[model samples]
Target chain A: SQQGEEDPQALSIQEGENATMNCSYKTSINNLQWYRQNSGRGLVHLILIRSNEREKHSGRLRVTLDTSKKSSSLLITASRAADTASYFCASTLNYGGSQGNLIFGKGTKLSVKP
Target chain B: GAGVSQSPSNKVTEKGKDVELRCDPISGHTALYWYRQSLGQGLEFLIYFQGNSAPDKSGLPSDRFSAERTGGSVSTLTIQRTQQEDSAVYLCASSLGPSGVGTQYFGPGTRLTVL
Candidate 1:
């Protein structure tokens, strides 16, 4: 079963606009990671925010995790057509053992119109 | 450095036939994983391997699905008696270790089609 669920199943915006996607999970997680898929093939690692960390930034990407709400959001500033792809949020359960594999969300398809 | 690689970018087979998919993880990486993605669906974990420890096969959907890793470098996922529902993108990934917080590198994935 999918532990996380991305919001706004789909999003569309013009180039240069910032795009934000949200993901909510039902269980306690050790960490939450974001990934991007282009052409529906390979997935690229975007960013990861550990449970103890609240926010992280890399290049033009900003991710915020609200453990209290059991949700996380990905923000892409100055979006470009190249950013057009599917974004997914995956979480690793906080079971008191080996971290194990990740549980992924359905993903949010973002379209950046040039 | 070379990233994870999978064989036969695409495969087409008839139902009831068996098929094998291969994954070669990055050199020196000790963790490997397999996942299945159906059209418009989230990725589902199929199996995981960490070093010499027994692989976690809890995610495998059936007895027909089996996987093995050799010499801690290459892994193969085999499906016995494939079904139409088995048609999906099979993805492979590898990381430095099994830490949940580590980033996993993914391959281009194999598009499996069952007729």
Candidate 2:
């Protein structure tokens, strides 16, 4: 079952603009993480935000998590053509046997035009 | 440090023929996971293994799918009587341990094509 769903299935933006993607999950979680996948490549971990953390910053990336809303958002500042890729949100359940599994969202396809 | 590695990056096989895909997680990593992504779809969890524990096979779609991890290092996913619907990119990942909060490193993936 999918634990997270990302808004804006596809987004096209011009270079240097900021791009934001939103993700909503179905259950309570311990952490929310973002990953990026280039064309025909495996996913790369971008950033992670704990349930208690309202927001976090990693270089040009920012992630915000809201346990109450069961939602999270990823922001890419000064988007570049190199940022063109699929972004996925994965949520880890708060407790129980499913704790070790990372349920992934369908992802948002972002295109940054140079 | 070497990252996760998957074997036979691409495989094309006939329906009803069985196929096995392999994954080698990073050294010292104790948690490994398998997932499959169909065209234009997000990843679907297949199974996961944590050091010395029975694998969690609840996510497997059908009885035809089975996986095993040996010595808690390399793992293999086997699909019996392959069908067209089984075509997808099978990905493998590993983290430091059983904690989901740890970062997962993924392999390039095995693109299985069933004809």
Candidate 3:
């Protein structure tokens, strides 16, 4: 499968603590994106990091891409109780002639306690 | 100013029945996509439509699943002879241009239960 796999299927942390999730993919990708889903509802785009970019930050979120290792990580600093959600890493790879069809990871379920 | 919207937020149907899910993408957005999310699972790509070009239906699981975009705006996904395994949340997303570099805005999704 071309889908990526996220480490630590579940993580629990206290409020104000930082949560880090790792993702490893099997193929070369154009970009990797992080998304947060509350319960089973729709997903909210968190951040995107291109292959050429080493790292990017958005607010309290940080994303890093290591193309040589085919791995990526998402770090959420000062996580709050509201940050509890299922986080997924999606990658876009060029297969045949199609581009940008996102293949998602199984996701990491994070719970932040207040 | 509005986001993607889906109808019949929840539906319960008997097996072997046909069902249709609707999605209204953000106005002016040219790229639309459909996905399925099973419980505790990742998003499964279903199909994609880019303006008037042919849709990429490579991710469709079977012939019983099909979708169509109307006037390059709204889209509908129809499932024929639905099976119990077909139960899932049908999600729709749209972006300003090509999804290769754009962020996709998703709808709340339509929850289908095949009993």
- What range of 10 consecutive residues in model 2 chain A has the weakest lDDT sum? A93-102
Q: Could you tell which candidate, 2 or 3, scores higher by lDDT?
A: 2
Which window of 10 residues has the lowest lDDT sum in candidate 1 chain A? A93-102
Instruction: Quantify all predictions' global Cα lDDT against the true fold.
Output: 0.91, 0.90, 0.89
> What stretches of model 1 exceed 4 Å from their correct place?
A97-99
All models, DockQ values? 0.76, 0.71, 0.67
TM-score of each: 0.97, 0.96, 0.95
Residue range A1-114, candidate 3, lDDT tens digits: 547999889999999999999999998887888999997988888998888999999999999999999999999999999999999998888555664668889999999999
The superposed Cα distance between candidate 2 and the true structure at residue B109, in angstroms, equals: 0.6
In the range B1-115, model 2's lDDT, one tens digit per residue, is 9999999899999999999999999999999989899975669878888874545677899999999889989999999999999999999999996868688889999999999
Q: What's the true lDDT of residue A37 in model 2? A: 94
State the TM-score of the second chain for every model: 0.94, 0.95, 0.94
* Tens-place lDDT digits, model 3, residues B10-91: 9999999999999999999998888899965557888888984545677889999999988989999999999999999999
Q: What is the C-alpha lDDT profile of model 2 across A1-114, one tens digit per residue?
A: 689999989999999999999999998888888999988569898998888899999999999888888899999999999999999999888887674778999999999999
What is each candidate's fraction of native interface contacts (fnat)?
Answer: 0.88, 0.69, 0.65
Residue pairs with backbone overlap in model 3? none
Off by over 4 Å in 2: none
